[model samples]
Target: MTLPYGRDDDSAAYHYINAALRGRDAEAWRLLAADSHVEQTDRVLRAMLDRIAVARTHRTAERATARARAAAGEITQAEYQRDAAEDATKASKTAHFETLLREHHRQIAQAARRLRGDDVRDELTDLVLALGAAVDAHRSAVLAAGYEPTPADEALWARLGELDVPDTDEGRTSVEDLVRRHAERQDDLGRVLAGIILDVAGAATSVPRSALLTEWKKTVAPTLAPEQKTEFAAKGKGSLATERLRKTMGHLERKGLVKRSPDGQRLDLLDRAGLADVADGRE
Candidate 1:
């Protein structure tokens, strides 16, 4: 009998059945059963029935194989029962983990909403702490199961330390304010770091200022709150505008206006040359 193995729809099955019948395949007609309501049966029903039948056949064959193995003394009944129980336990654990992951994502979404001030301040703090604990627990469980946490997860946990939840309401407010301030400071530091990286590493291989600016806007800006963004934007502009300052300093050092150590770590600023370079740049 020809089955609709590759057919995606009833039309395809109909074509296959017609072709089989035209080729005088009696088994195909018997499989189709003239009294069966093919019009009422959807392709999904047929596919599901086929799958169930295949599963049943597999179970029967497996049972027979197991019986033969037991007869040959290749496996014990106790061993087979133990293996079956282990498989069931593994499947249950997998299902439990899937549920936990779904809950985790749901909780994170709730925490994000709370972060946006959709919930009470105290409630938001509790939610954030709960979410963080859940994530840490999940990470520990996965690691225990021999799965390594991604670098991103590790980075997040490190950043969470900077979040430092406080007990008192005043302390919590202070912590939140500190987080905002630190984020701004980090952005300003990043600009300095990017400029320093360009200078010390040489400008030819460095990312363009425009690209760095775009990266800063996309990555560093949103890390701060909305109000903090306005405050930090001015600071960032000032820091970024000092890009030529490093190069000018290097030039002055070469001219004996500044004495830099071999490693460029310490700078002994020579007053005359430093003033001259600054004056020259201004001119």
Candidate 2:
């Protein structure tokens, strides 16, 4: 016999059973069962349809719950990984800065050894003090630039005070100007540093080594003491100038004042400190 929508009777029954199993209208099956000539067969079909409906409902609910749990687990895992990465980065930066500080101390000690004509101990102490002042000025610039000062940073500033570099009007003006300039350039410098760090952290990191060195020299040149500035200018001839410039740039690079691009020719400006930070080795 033909059924609704011109389908044969058997096909109509099959469609009704499928609708019930898929969680569609179960009442349609009941209406179909009422009109069937085979009473016993119709009753069996109705029972099977009811069971399928119930099973479908339960299965759908279970699947939904499982999906929610999986999503939450994924979020938690991602957060953990991000935190771990940040911690490792902080540790590495701290280690690098400490190494720079030690080298600075070593340089002062060597200078003291070379100048044996004076009271060597006093001279060494004075040089260390000067270094400390330079570090302090640099720290002030960092803080002014919105960076949190670490304990090591604080110690460096304190050591600068211990070094009896006379706080002349000119010195004060230079240091204050350096702080202001650094603060102004903080955001730009931060972006550059972030880019550098991201590249270094990536699988195929490659940046031009010399670019950082050149930028460091440029950043610090304006802040150096008159004598040091003269010395640097005088040495900037032929190969000697290149070597001195490289050394100066290297010093600034260690202090985080400059960033290098991947190509090595492009030196990106990262920070600004008046002549003081550069002169004091705080750049």
- Model 2 C-alpha RMSD to native: 32.4
Q: What does candidate 1's lDDT look like per residue over 149-220, in tens digits?
A: 799877765665556665443554333344445445433543443444344334233234344444444544
lDDT of 2 at 5: 31
- Model 1: residues with Cα > 4 Å off, grouped in runs: 1-119, 169-283
Clashing pairs in 1: none
TM-score of 2: 0.21
TM-score to true structure, per model? 0.18, 0.21
The residue-by-residue lDDT of candidate 2 on 1-283, one tens digit each, is 3225322455555554445435534354344333332233233343443444455456557556655655778446565556556755765765564344333323332333334332454465446544544665687689889998889877656554343332334443333344344444443344334344333334433335454344534544444443333222322322333444454444446556555566545444454442224544343
lDDT of 2: 0.45
Clashes in predicted model 1: 0
Window of ten residues with lowest summed lDDT in model 1? 227-236
